[model samples]
Target: MAHDHHEHDDSCGDECGHNHDHSHEHNPTDELVTVRDLIRYATSRFNRNKLVFGHGLQDAYDEAVYLVLHTLHLPIDRLEPFLDACIPTDERTEVLEIIHRRSDERIPAAYLTGEAWLGEFRFTVDERVIIPRSFCAEALADGLSPWIDDASQVTRALDLCTGSGCLAIVMAHCFPSAQIDAIDLSPDALEVARINVEDYGLQDSIRLIQSDVFSALKDERYDLIVSNPPYVTAASVDALPPEYLHEPAMALGAGEDGMEIVRRILRDAHQRLTPNGILLIEVGHNRAEFEAAFPALEPVWLTTTSEEEKLLLLRADQLAA
Candidate 1:
């Protein structure tokens, strides 16, 4: 499905939001607070409450810090200097109200804050689109260097099933010469993508289209084509945590084996790629299924720090549509 950006470090129990153990030394109404103090208390509350950590940060400490700093409009990476800076009384109250909502409502930190991070780039996110948590973001940040033979040759690109337009925007930023077409089936997701596209001021470089996949592209070809299409199985969707339930299912479930959308992409991509074009798709946890599904064509698997990434690369000729 979508790159959920979940960490395996902790799982959200079914009743995670229902139980809260208030054993922390700091209360929400504690007097005389600093950014560091607020983060500490929120982390403790998060861990004590046993909520899931994924949508943004992997641990309570980092997530809490992000929540506090982002909420206050402080630079998150520059927190070392402002750890002890006393938070304004009113700001502290506003911060805790959200911190409480984060745990109590069982919503993702991104959805709660209405923003998500794909590396340093920020996007406006809500329930309409899946959080911008694809490993492709990291892959793009590396300039897609390891796989692409020549980045300079990548003049035209396509971002299929480009939820929130994260991949398209990031790729456009990384590959300055490239013009990317981002297509998705859902209007709601496209609306969210449109916001991020406009926010990044890339309307000229990136175009958003509402298409199921390559249906609207016709004979258009690209030097690079990338997709993070829905690849989650029906079984997995049913088993996903409630935090995942907040995301749109269209961005999640595929067919019985989770190969429904990916299969079509593989079959149709050859017609849309240049002779030397490269196709990169994130299959996520369906690595084995993908390998088995396409037994003859060998895909160059790309690795990322996030375990959820099962990125594979193939050339246009290898696809042979």
Candidate 2:
């Protein structure tokens, strides 16, 4: 499950006769008129340039539609009604410029748009924080059922590597009575998280802290701890596409095998978890390495709509053992 880049056909430009020349810029005022025209051109341009699209949307068409609709200040979900509508010259240029930056500079759509969505929740985002994408969001939305029989019972929780504090805010919604702590090593990321927490009016329920893993939490304990830490291996991080390079590298790479931070979390988690507390962590595609690193401990893999075994749950007793 590679997360950074998606494979695209290299022969498309040759087969479709679209000029691959990077020097010649297309004049949107002359060539593009309608919203449909802009979407078509942006999608084709992105496909020809082989732009990566893992930040928020999946394929070229979806990203193009989102960008055009967003640039025009139109409703993103109702694209069919405005497809034939003519775009004003200034708005058209604005759309074209954004599309060019996306294709030419390879900036992730979230960074370009300044916001990202996880499920139905939206958060402010920029280059300071990794775009919020985690299976932990889904698990939390489901109230982490079966294991977490009652959401209100969770009086306190923690979100480690909490970039933009997206998941921590989600935790506030899921467990309304719970006090949440969100931690990240980068102060810039913490600042972004602070914005999101305030945006959601969660300043009282959610707290943002800067720390290298759990270093700053001296005697704090929690009924639940969740983390979507940096798990990309050094090799994988080095090979990521240009779009991923826009994000902070420290938020992506963990070490040679991607288990460095995971090791630190495991070593200290038991001491900070309440007797009946639970821990959930997302490792993306590094489960194999995680199992290899800790063969003795067994954790229950939680199911989510998006991926298989991307998240794991460990009980306090299991962690103690």
Candidate 3:
């Protein structure tokens, strides 16, 4: 897939661009443009522009409300009840601008607002890291509980390429007795991770390290290792929607074949895994390529409602060669 950046010069007309004036009353401002009204309008606009794939109008509305409430630092639960709660003129203007940016420039709400929530952990986000929406969160929330027979037996866990520290935090919460090593290659990405670590009060349980894959890991071993690495191939990268443009290229593209990172992870995983260690990685629709790369290994494929995701569960004993 091609990794070229999509650029918009903001040349679209008022109806389609950011220049539309949302200030005037005569602008068809939904008579009672409550918080609900604003959300509806934003959702309609986003759906019309195809911002979300397979998501219905209601999904779009919820997402828009989510972004708006998140941008204002309000809880999502408080949104519906406060629909008619007067929004200051300045705040309304700011929100309109954000909606415009989303509709016209195609910037993702997470990137535009610089924040995202994964499970219960909310992290500071930006173009430096991809938005945290991994199915791993679901697995982790279920106690990570279903996967392990004895949580207390887990001494160490690894959140490889930790990004914004969402997985690491979730692991920390799930396995209170386990210490987590959150590793990432990019310093900028690590900065975001640090914020989340501190935010979740897991600084002591989760150790943030700057290293490329197993380089900083050295002789360290872990009972559990989880990763949601970049798996987008050159072709898939080219076909991604405009919202994907808001994410960093390095956080999405995995080279020509897209197995560059996964291959490396598989090669080095055995050395870092303890006797009964488990490795869970999200391959996200690249399962065919992954299976083709490691034909000798039979990885347990896991699925979710999201069509793009394909998680694989591997054990250290299976990797013993």
Instruction: State residue 142's C-alpha deviation in candidate 2, in Å.
Output: 0.9
**Cα lDDT, model 3, residue 270:** 92
TM-score to true structure, per model? 0.87, 0.90, 0.85
C-alpha RMSD for every candidate: 8.6, 8.0, 9.1
Instruction: Residues 1-321, candidate 1: write the lDDT tens digits.
Output: 123332332323333222335576654356425776688889998989888876768888888988997898766775666676666668888999889998887789999888898887889999999887788887777678866756677899999998899999989988888989999999999999999999989999999999988987778999989899999988888898778889999899998889999989988899999998889999889998887888998888888896554898898989885
Better of 2 and 3 by lDDT: 2
* Better by TM-score, candidate 2 or 1: 2
Give the per-residue lDDT digits (tens) of candidate 2, residues 1-321. Answer: 112222432222223323334467855345566788789999999999999888768899999999998888776776766776666678888999999999999999898899998988889999999999889999888789888899989999999999999999999999999999999999999999999999999999998988898899889999999999999999999899999999999889999999999999998999879999999999988889999999988999877875568998998888784
Worst 10 residues of 3 by lDDT: 1-10
RMSD of 3: 9.1
Segments of candidate 2 deviating more than 4 angstroms:
1-29
Model 1 bad stretches (over 4 Å): 1-28, 307-309
Query: Which should have the higher lDDT, number 1 or number 3?
Result: 1
Candidate with the greatest lDDT versus the true structure? 2
List ranges where model 3 is wrong by over 4 Å. 1-32, 53-58, 71-74, 86-88, 145-147, 307-309
Q: Write the per-residue lDDT of candidate 3 for residues 70-121, one digit (tens) a residue.
A: 6555556554455654455566667777888878898777777777777556
Per-residue lDDT, model 3, residue 50, is 74
